[model samples]
Target: MQTVKNFSDAELITAIKTGTNIDNAVGFIYRSYYRMLENFVLTNSGNEMDAEDIIQEVLVVFIDIVQTQRYRNEASVRSFLYTLTRNLWISELRKRNSDSKRNGFFEASREKEEEDVSDFLIYKEAQVLIVELFERMGEKCKQILTLFYYENLSMKEILKQTSYENEQVLRNRKYKCLKELTDIIQQSPTIINNVKSALQRSK
Candidate 1:
């Protein structure tokens, strides 16, 4: 196998920002960080697949931060990357613990250091709740809402993809679906509490 090229902190940041040499930079990042992060997750009650998924998600967030010039040079890129990945994994653990509690399973205790990740964990919890509530919506509502909001499709584009008779009808359906989702969210005490907690943490 060919050796993947390595990148220094400056080199990697430059490549990511300029959108050039990105493939090699990303390859280097994965090769360099994967094993360490994988070992961390595996030791912390997660499996290899969980480590892979968490790394992928954290990489996406890292890339976005780099692209948007939001990455401060306060720390080395590797350290920053590892911190983000660790925080994300901790949030995942907290979410899983919450699920286990709901199922009457034994919940694991978290470390004091993990409490620092509560803001992110709360945000992630609210996000999961929204997704769950969205899935509980009617199939038609799900489709139209996804096409319009998540997919960022225009009304005309949605009409083409869907079997809607006209843009107006699709618009009406979208409004109703949104209202339904909003009502469902409003009625969900768990979601309400999570959102409130997230907001308070943000403040």
Candidate 2:
């Protein structure tokens, strides 16, 4: 895997188009966009499973275009991939809702406002770390933390959702889950500092 440096989008495209194979090309795309796509999916009403499936679909679509020599350099490859993934996710949500009897409606899309490239990079890295930390926790921890933090549901809401007997039990579980997440963040010094820098830079 070659490290993706400062290659202009045009140069990368040319290399990809002329190379004997697509391994490097695919890796470059993954390294550049995987975190952004994952964060977009997870933050936009997608679960980890949904995010994984969507990313795979995005890669498949990208590869198909590349193999068919159809990826024009009219726009940055990054923008093209992001738009493709976004459209695919929207299409998937419509399909899912159409197939199921669920009553909840999909919310409006949240487009990330453009920021300094460095800040965007760090913010994305932080999100990736948080997602990994959540995945590493126990199932109970994941559910509790996600309800309180990611879903922004109140204690009563969490209690009802989890079917807990009382508020006290819910509070205890929430505290424990949050503590575990904090510990995970504390352990990753590089990620913590990077995120801090990103936030500071944004301000």
Give candidate 2 regions above 4 Å deviation. 1-7, 19-21, 98-203
The lDDT for every candidate, in the order shown, is 0.66, 0.60
**Cα lDDT for residue 58, model 2?**
64
Give the TM-score of each candidate. 0.51, 0.44
Alpha carbon deviation, residue 32, candidate 2 (Å) = 1.5
Q: Provide the lowest-lDDT 10-residue window in model 2.
A: 113-122
Scored by TM-score, the top model is: 1
Candidate 2: Cα lDDT at 47: 70
Error of 1 at 170 (Å): 28
Task: For model 1, give the 10-residue run with minimal summed lDDT.
Answer: 98-107
Q: Estimate, for each residue in 1-203, the C-alpha lDDT of model 2 and write its tens digit.
A: 95555445776676555553355666777787888988877876777766665676566545434433446455577876676666656555654444342223234343342123223333433455456778978988888767654565655667788867986677666656655655565467675665566455555
**Colliding pairs, model 1:** none
